[model samples]
Target: MCAAGLAWEPLLRLCLSASLVGCQNSKSFEPPS
Candidate 1:
């Protein structure tokens, strides 16, 4: 259980960071009106 918790922590953080970066990139790449 301890080992699983340790591994899961970084995976969760990576997913969160990736989602945030994707959102920022999408906003930046929008076409101008």
Candidate 2:
């Protein structure tokens, strides 16, 4: 169904964005030297 697909698109995008932010946060951290 096109309507369901459209609704899921936003949810998928939000999930992707959240994961990307999490990835960036992890990547930005560093261990003590």
lDDT of each: 0.97, 0.91
Weakest lDDT window of 10 consecutive positions for candidate 2: 24-33
How does candidate 1 score on lDDT?
A: 0.97
Give the TM-scores of the predictions, in the order they appear.
0.80, 0.66
Candidate 2, residues 1-33: lDDT per residue as tens digits? 999988998999999999999998887895656
lDDT of 1 by residue, 1-33 (tens): 999989998999999999999999999999997
Among these predictions, the greatest lDDT belongs to 1
TM-score of 1: 0.80
